[model samples]
Target: MNIIIWNCRGVLKPSFKKRVGDLVQNHNPAILVVMETRVGGDKAREITNLLPFDGAIHTNTIGYAGGLWVLWNTDRVEIALLSKTEQEIHTEVKVRLTNLSWILSAVYASPRNAERQVLWENLMSVADLHNMPWVIAGDFNEPLLSEDKFGGRAVSVNRSLLFKECLDKCNMLDIGFAGPRFTWSNRREVQALIQERIDRFFVNPSWCVMYPNAKITHLTRCHSDHCPVLLEMQPRIQNGRSRPFRF
Candidate 1:
C-alpha cells in the first residue's frame, strides 16, 4: 500500500483537479492526505466528491486558513476516523488484503510556536491512547534539524526542542527519504529564496518492524510550495522477483 501527503495550499485553483489526477496516475496512492486546502463548507464537499477517490473526509477551514482532507480508496483500505482538530486528523487504517491495521495521523501544524506546542501536547496524548503500530506524515512546518533548512535564518535548536521531544516521547522515527533534501521552498528570487525539509513521514518501532522495506520519496513540487511525499509500505517486486537492495 502507498500514501501521499501534500500541502496543496488551496483546492480552488484552476489546476487543482488536474494536479490531483496527475498524482493519482503517477503514484497510485491508496490514500491522499491534503493540508492547507483553504476551502471548506459546501464547496469543499462538492470538490471532494469529484476527486478520484472512493471516499473522503474534510476538516472545515478556519476562515480561509487551514483545512485538511483525507481521501482513500475503500477498495484498498478501510479508514475509521478517531479524532480531529483544525491541525490534525487521526484515523485507524486497515489494509483489505492483508488485514493489517495501524494508526495514521495527518498533520498540518500551525506556523506559530505557541500553537505548535499545543499540537505537540495533543499528539502525545493521542500517542498514549493506543499501542498499535503508528505512522504520521504531513507538513510539520518546523524542521527537526539545523541542516533541514537552507538560505534562511538559521534554525533554532531551542525552538525545535519541543518537536524533537515529542517525537522522542512518542517513539517515532523519521523514516528517511530518497529524493531532494528539502521538501518546501519560498518561490522567490535567488537572493531572497528560503527552503526547508518540513514535510515528512514518522513511524513507531512496531510499524518499522511490520513494513521493513517501507520507502519515502520527496516528489518534485509542482502546484504548491511543498513537495508531495510518497510512502510505499513494501519493496517493489519486478518480474516476480524482489529487486536487489542498495545502500
Candidate 2:
C-alpha cells in the first residue's frame, strides 16, 4: 500500500480539492496525512467529508495556525487511533485480510525550537511505550542534517543535536528518498531562496524487516511549499489475498 504525507500549508485554498484529487488519482494512497490545514470546527469536518475517503480524524487548528487530518479508506486497512497532540497523531494500522500490523505516527512539528523540544520529548515517551514495527513521517520543520538545507542560515547546532539525540534514543532511522533532495522551498527569487529537506520518513528496524522493499519518493511540490511524500511497499501474498502494506 501507499501512504502519502504532505504539509499542504492550508486546506482552505480554492485549488485544495483539485490538488488532493490529483494526489489520490496519481498515488492511490491507502492512508493520507495532511498537515497545516489551517481550518477547524464544522468547516473542517465538512471539507473532510467531501474528500474521497471512508473515514478521517483530525486535530483542530489553533487560531489560523496548525491543523492535521489523517484520512483513510476502511476497505484498504483498519486504523485505530492510539494518541494525539497538536504536534502528532499515533495510530495502529492493520492491513485488511492480513495479520500484518504496525504503528504510524504523523507529525507536524512546530517551527519554534522550544516547542519542537516538547515534540521530541513526547516522541521519546512514545518510543518507550511501543516496540512494534513503526513508521514516523511528516513535516518535521527542522532539518536533521546540515546538508538538508540550502541558501539558508545554517541549521542550528543545538536544535539538530537534540533532534539527533531523539532519533538515537528512539532507534528510528531515516529511510531516505528518491526524486528532489529538498522537500520544501521558500518560493522566493533564486537569490533569496531557501530550501530544506524537512519532510521525511523514519522507520524502526523491525519495520525494515517487514517491508524490505519499501521505498519513499519526494513528489514535485505544487499546492504547497512542501512536497507530497509517497511511501510504497511491496505486496506480500498470503493464501489468495495480497497485503499491500507487506503502513
Candidate 3:
C-alpha cells in the first residue's frame, strides 16, 4: 500500500490543482494526508471534490491559519476520523493489504516553543492510549537535526532535545531520505539562504517491523515550500489466497 503526505499550502489556484492532480495520478497512493489547506467550509468541500480519491475529511482553520485534510481511496481502504485538536487532525484507516489497521496523523505544530511542546505531549498521550501502528507525518515546522537544515544555521538546541524526547516517548522512528536534505526552502534572492527538512514521516516501531521494505519517495516540489513525502510499503500476499500447486 502507498501513503502520501503533502503540505499543499492551499488548493485554491488552478495551477496548484493541476500540480496536485498530476501527483495523484503518478503516485496513486492508497491514503493521502494534506496540511495547510488554508481553506474552510465550502471552499474545503470544493477543493476535496477536485481530488481523485473517493472520500476526504477536512479540518478547517478559523481565519486561514492552520488546516488539514485526508483523502483516501474508499474502495480499498476504510477511514475513520479519530479526533481533532486545535493543532492537529487525526484519523484511523485500515489498509486492504494485511487487513492491518493504521493511524494517519496529520499535524501542523505551532511555531511557539511552549505550544509545540504541549502539542507533542498530547500526541504521545493519544498514541499511548490507542496502542496501534501509526504513521505520524506532516510539517513539524521544526527540524530534528543540524543536518536537516542548510545555510550553516544550527538546529535549535531546545527544540531538538524536545523532539528527540517526544520521539523516544512515542516509540517513533524517523524514516530519513537521501534526496534534498531540506523539504522547505526560502524563496529569496540571497544565494546563501536556502532549505531545511522540517517535514517528516515518523512511524511506530511495529509499523516499521511490519513493512520493512517501506520507503520514502521524494517528489518534485510544485506548489508548496515543502515537497511531498510518499511512504511506499511492499505488497503483502493474503493468507490462503494462493494455491500450493507449482506451475
Candidate 4:
C-alpha cells in the first residue's frame, strides 16, 4: 500500500485543500498522515470531513500551533490504535488484500530544538518492542547529516549526532527517496531560499525484509512550504524491474 506523509503547515486554507484534493485524485494514497494542521474541534471536523478517506484519528491543534492527523481508506487497511499523544499516532495497520500487518507511526517532533530529545526518547520507547515490521514517517525536525539540507546555514553537528544516535538506538534506516532532495523550503529569493529534507520515513530491518523494493517519492511543493512525500511499499515498476536495495 502507498502512504503519504506531509507537513501541510496549515490546512484551513481552501487553496491548500484544493492542492491536497488534487493529490488525492492522482496518487490515491491508502493512508495519509498530515503534520501541523493547526486546527481543532469543530473547525477541524469542518475541514477533514471533506476528505475522501472514511476513517481518521487526529489530535487537535493547540492554539494554532501543532496537530497530527492520520486518515485511511477503511476498505484497504484496518487500523487498530496502540497509543497516542500530541506528537504521535501509533497503530497496527493491516492490509486487507495481502493479510500483512505491521506497526505504523505518524509522528511530529516538536519544533523547539530544546524539546526534541524527549520526542526521540518517546519514539525509542516504542521501538523497544520489535516484534513486527515498522514504518515511521513524519517531519522529524532534525537532520541526520549536513547533506540532507540545502541553501541554509550549516546544520549543527551536535544536533545531527543526537538524531543519528537515536535512530541507531532504534535500528532505523532512512528509506530511499526518488524525487527532489528537499521537502521543505523558505520560498524566498535565490540568495535567501533555504531547503531541507526534514520530512521522511525510517524503517527497521524487518521492513526491508517484507518489502525489499520499497521506495519513497517527494512531490513538488504546492501551496505549502512543505512538499508531500509518498512511500511506495509495492515499488513502482520501471523498465519491467523493481528497484533493488540491500538490507
The better-scoring model by lDDT among 2 and 3 is 2
Please list all clashing residue pairs in model 1, or write none if there are none: none
Model 1: residues with Cα > 4 Å off, grouped in runs? 237-247
Please list the C-alpha lDDT of all candidates, in the order they appear. 0.88, 0.87, 0.77, 0.84
Q: Which ten residues in a row have the lowest lDDT in candidate 2?
A: 238-247
TM-score of 3: 0.89
Pairs of residues clashing in candidate 2:
1-244
Clash number for each model: 0, 1, 0, 0
lDDT per residue (tens digit) for residues 13-76 in model 1: 8988999999999989999999999988788889989999977878878788999899999999
What is candidate 3's lDDT per residue for 1-247, written digit by digit as tens? 7778888787775677777777778877888888887787888887778778888887767487777777888888998888876567788888775688878787877667788888889887886777788788888888887877877468888888888888777778765553566788886656767688877788887777777767776777877877998777763432222211110
For candidate 4, what is the lDDT?
Answer: 0.84
List pairs with backbone clashes in candidate 4: none
Model 1, poorest ten-residue lDDT window? Answer: 238-247
Error of 3 at 172 (Å): 0.5
Backbone clash total for model 4 is 0
